[model samples]
Target: MALKELEVRYATKRSRDYKLADGEGLHLLVRPNGSKLWRMKYRFEGREKLLSFGAYPQLGLAEARLKRAAARLELAAGRDPGARPDRKPAMTFEKAARAWHEHRAASLDPGHAARTLARLERDAFPALGKTDIRAVTSADVLAMVRSVEARGALDVSRRLKQHVSQIYRFAIPHGWADTDPAAYLSDLLKPKPRVRHMARVGMEELPKLVQAIDAYDGEETPRRRAVTRAALLFTLFSWARTNETRLATWDEFEGLETAEPLWRVPAARMKMEREHLVPLSTQAAALLVSLREISKTGFVFPGDKPNQPISQNTMIYGCYRMGYRGRQTVHGFRGLASTWANEAESYRPDWIEMALAHAERDEVRGAYNSALYLTPRRRMLQDWGNLVEHMVTSDAGVRRDDVEEVGPPLTAVA
Candidate 1:
């Protein structure tokens, strides 16, 4: 008999089992102990599956019907809820973001990834992260971005948009959300203004700057003195990105090769996403070898913790100690190299691009090849390093009278 609510309610607690069918594969089972339970019978992969809703009147008739309808829709979409024999409960954005962080944290320099996630949690998660992934919309994301923009942190707001887009993309592949709202809001959000690269110090100013750094005498703070000297020489010889070479570790380096020892930075740490072999001239190698003796613990330039590389702010403090306030920065070293390297025709345009880790200008070649030009790059770096060493010691023979030419390509065996 088709069971009604009143009939089932009026039934006294008898020592018998009763079966009640609600059609469309849903059934309610009333036990002898007066407990009512809901269950659904379905088939998938040629095997029968049973899904339980909950006990009534806890779940109630109306709620159970709604759940059954949703389950039927999932079945129609070819997803079997009963497929996973050991399914865990859903994870929240905070949990997912932490998991993403753990995997990506060590790839970059210290604390960058962690700081990014902390910002996301503090500014982003509070608004929409707690809500179920599927429930978030474009409006929700737009509002969060607008809030950041209102704070006058335009750069941060722009970055937040990218981070949120990454999170959304992360969520979509993991079945958390359907679309990335931030991806659609690019035109809607304010565009960040272009920032000019720091100007390279001119030849006339270079001598004065070098003289100032050389003549400066400060208290014997081992870490401060060593790191500052290292930064100055590193800027000259390496001619690589200040941030890239700043996070150097003992494990990453290989000893001097032939005339000048070349330090090969692993592809993982490089901005180019390819292995970079840097030519360490006599001056650069001497600086590194000396630094190794003092900072033998872990990093080449150890920080206050004595286990990590020197802090990013150390260069600023070093500049202050050197009696150069509002002069040039540690990063200004790259500008010096860039301007000089570009002026020299001996350096191939491609070699300069590779050294800078810039992508290939040729669309056809860039599409097929992503790795940086390593072979000619090694020679170019060596030439650049040698030039810097020559200039430092006031060697007139080291004049830029000749072009910077790359000798041959270096094949990395390992």
Candidate 2:
């Protein structure tokens, strides 16, 4: 059953591929296509595995035996040479993902860098992380993307797909990979899902909603009720995102009691992972002043648990309670302010955009100064805060006593 060089060269093609024995699990596979290939079987980690040497003729019997002996040596030393780190077979998706992330960590904002890994762990890693980078097919990458897509996270799906593509491209020059499986993946993508911005409300609805918020009496605990109200009002007055609002700490606020107040949201807390300065309107600063009284914990809006930030869903449910659940969102306050300012048309659009902390189209302008449009923004926020007070205090066909309590005594969804 031993494979001889002359005999293997003359071996006839079979209806199906058959192996010519060379003992020790090494064999010459005679394919129907008249090709002779060398292969060996071995074991590692209590599992049987296979390794390829080379094609016969080019890899004669003596050389094949040498390669097999080397492989067995590697196995005895507790190594799988078949999947060595230098080889394509050993390059795992998780390993490559780590490499790609680390390669750009220095340049990327820490928060963005952290989220990229977090997302890969959450969505891609569980499915294909251990798979060999070369072994991962386009179908494999698409399957991972579709899982996110099925949840209707269209933007997340797109972002994750781009990440997969980047991973493959990064691995290519490093020699751990050869093929770009993620290339041209968008062709296989399902129909574009609707663009879903965070749920937020317009100006006309802002006032009526505020009136309902005032009526929210939570179990008659005045401190908790007051904290909740202040949190939402603070979110509006600062035009900060829910996470920004909830996680805000007293130390981050400067000059709240002074003539000029500023809430400096650090890069770690921002979506873009950059430092943002929020010019506090009198109302916003006043809310923070009141908040400091009740909050012994550093977090401006402490959660039910001590010292922790408030639940992200707290304000959304507050909206739900006010019978404006669908009509308004905690984030909608930003949109409302934007709407009010743009309609005012008195301020420059760039200044308004800067106030909103939108990523500036001009990179130079975006990164130029943290307080690029401070004076005008202070005035804009003051005017907006005045509008908010009028909306909350004035009767806009919504009586305070008539509004319902927060979505029925349910535990706040964390």
What RMSD value applies to candidate 2?
12.3
For residue 326, what is the lDDT in candidate 1?
Answer: 64
Candidate 2's TM-score: 0.57
Q: What's the number of clashes in each of the models?
A: 7, 1
- The Cα local distance difference test for each model comes to 0.63, 0.75
Model 2, span 296-358: residue lDDT tens: 898988878977877878778777766775777887788888888999998888778878778
Where is model 1 more than 4 Å wrong at Cα? 1-120, 130-135, 149-156, 166-179, 193-200, 207-227, 240-249, 256-282, 290-325, 345-370, 393-414
Q: How far is candidate 1 from the true structure (C-alpha RMSD, Å)?
A: 16.0
Index of the highest-lDDT prediction = 2
| lDDT, candidate 1, 1-414, per-residue tens | 445777545655556655577878787867666877777777766755566687787887777778889889989999985444375436556566666667667875454665678788878888766655544556777888899988888867777777777777677678665445576787898776686665445666775555444333442654455455566556566776655666777777666434547677766666544566665555566556655556757677666675777677766566667665666666777677667778877777777776666657575697576565566666776666555544344322221311111111011000
Error of 2 at 322 (Å): 5.6
